[model samples]
Target: MNEPFAGAAEKPIPEIWYGIPHGYVQVDLDPPVEQIEELVQQVLALPDGLRAQAEPVVQFYAGFVTALNKQNARACLLGMHLDEYDEPATSVITFSTVPAHGTSAKAIIAGTAADTVDGSAHPLELPAGLAYFSEEERRTPAPGRPAEGSDGPLMGDIWQGTVAVTGSGGSEIVVIQLVTSAVEMAEDFRNILLGVAHTLSFSDPSLSGDEAGTGAREPEPDSVVAAVRSVFG
Candidate 1:
């Protein structure tokens, strides 16, 4: 249970967090937790020019954490940028969980797949009774002021997955998200996302003490490169 994120607990703020039931899972990304917090603090301390660009992302992280807390996620891995920025940026892998009251894994898969004509959904073949995958493109026009690079709209891709596992005396849906800025990088991002999700293992910490289980974990050397390449490449 706590063994997985033990390093997080060692930090002053702790990068890894476990939920009350400890039914969900977590995977460490680059920069960890303390670095992300420190990055945020540095951005906040900046004067006006660069701070304006980074503020939205800082706010977004705050709001996202709030949302996950409200959803009663038992454990999660926080991912974010460690460097300064002038505009809003997205996290690489955001994990969270919510109660699925009788929601069939098939229903979740179908609904997620139906969101895009080009996207496909398939079973994860893991311990979890149900798992789903979906990939899609997103577009955002320049609002008021354009983002750093382009003169027009911005395009990005999102890879999402869900695993339904019952443990900790209840059932929960594990949500995985990989967001990047392009269509060409979809496949790469999807592979990395699946790697993380495939490693997910659920257990009832209340019943099993400190030992939680694991799934078919994939060894990804340089996860940071995988994440960045998915967007920049």
Candidate 2:
């Protein structure tokens, strides 16, 4: 049987479009074993001694996709960023839609913000219609300076940014979620997300790939994916 998000078929109707910068790569839950091997060895640049660890890593992301798909996700992308020291190398962004049916975009946005605990949403100025940005933190680590008790927490913190907007046709609500464990770099993540959010547009659902001169800046570039493609192929 085909696994969840394993090369999901393209939807034929008009869909939402946005920018993905150079550091991100789209995820595919299922791909050939050979490609997976190449992903560990090449894209990730993992050493041969750690070769056996790739399977578990793949399985973790498969579960991640499965969770999103269960909630009506439309697309998933993984970001592997490396600084001068390659710190905080992973982040994830997911695009999903909630059936608006007949609900007003204001109600949807307000209700979402209200439901969140300690949720704060602010007006987002964008080309897209009626958008709000909300941030939520789950299982935050112990409150203290980073250098002290850094390893005390059994689990790392989870940070997420939810960007909700009215669908192009008012029939659905587009939700773009950005998540990462690097809570310390929240400001950087927020800036990156805004760059992407500004580019949002509703377009053909079956829009195969990034088209030239469409004013759609790719969030992830083709060259960035050549290696990432193997990881999530």
Best by TM-score: 2
> Per-residue alpha-carbon lDDT of model 1 for 1-233, expressed as tens digits?
21322122332211222221112234432336787789888998999988998898777666666665575433445333222334433334555555557775456554665564565555555443456666656554422554798666654444343433332223445565655543354565466566555444443212233222453333244232232233233
* Model 1 whole-model lDDT (C-alpha atoms): 0.46
lDDT at 125, model 1 = 52
Tell me the whole-model lDDT of each prediction, alpha carbons only: 0.46, 0.64
Worst 10 residues of 1 by lDDT: 13-22
User: 1-233 in candidate 2: lDDT tens per residue?
Assistant: 01111222355233765555667777764456787676655635666566556656666666776787688777777887765476756788887777776878667776765676664787565666777898877886543346665656555687798888877776677788898877777777777676566556664222325654475433343232222232234
Off by over 4 Å in 1: 1-91, 103-119, 141-144, 147-170, 204-233
Clashes of each: 3, 6
Give the top-scoring candidate (lDDT): 2
